[model samples]
Target: MPFTLVLPDGIQYVGLAFVSTIWLQIGQAVLVMSARKTAGIAYPRLYAEKAEEEASFLARKFNCTQRAHQNTLEQLPAIYTATVLSALKYPVFAASALGLWVIGRILYTSGYMTGEPQKRNTRGGFIGSLCTFALTCTGTYSIISLALAAA
Candidate 1:
């Protein structure tokens, strides 16, 4: 069953971004599960060993999925922080950016699973990372500027 969300007017876009964030997480988890299943990697240690077998189709795909998920994890903290700050200050823009990020991630996962290496560099994953970078930079700057001004 799919989950549903309904937000009030004042926080609508923020709510949407939050929902999208959860969806992104869920999507990544699904990729991990798929990779694990494909590679017969029920154990983490086994996965660690087998994940290096790029010669095998399942292993290669699993490694790709794992890498994508790891990359997302590395970026998620900053993205979430930026989303919160942007939501507080500019809900609509934040939502738009976050929603696009989610879409890009979906494309990234799809491409990676299907052995589309260029997707990370020439496609959706790269575009999503750019969005995350922009938002993180802007949010950090905004916060620091506000702090400096107050001080």
Candidate 2:
């Protein structure tokens, strides 16, 4: 056999981190679905659009949950890209940061579920932002370094 695949050390942790993100996304979706049911929101309505005074508390709560999940979905592309690129040269750090980001998202979602939008700016959000920044920087550096070395 002439073909072989050699994965970087600590790739397992990176794989686990990716799996955790998948589960986190699913969990957030489930929460939003449950909240929609509680709020009596019908299908195809993205959110409760009534005036604040007219909207029921449950409806407001459901909107909050939905927004939290949507926000997570928006961030996933950046998270996945940074994770994969950074893992090529810094698998352990990349995986660690990604793991923290997942935890932070969970906390951010829980806080947002309280129906107080301000609560969404929790420590978890800060942590997640910091981790994303680190990952982006690391991934950029890794790619540039690899390219220069190949030249």
How far residue 90's Cα lies from its native spot in candidate 2, in Å, is 0.6
Candidate 2, residues 1-151, lDDT tens digits: the string is 6998777899999999999999998999899999999988888988987774156888888999999999999999998999889998999999999999999999999998888888888737898999999999999999899899999
Q: Clashes in each model (backbone N, CA, C under 3 Å)?
A: 0, 0
User: Which stretches of model 1 miss by more than 4 angstroms?
Assistant: 1-10, 46-52, 148-151
TM-scores, all candidates, are 0.77, 0.94
Question: Any residue pairs clashing in model 2, and if so which?
Answer: none
Kindly state the number of residue pairs that clash in model 2: 0
In Å, residue 110's CA in model 1 sits off its true spot by: 1.6
- Top model number, TM-score: 2
Per-candidate Cα lDDT values, in order, are 0.74, 0.91
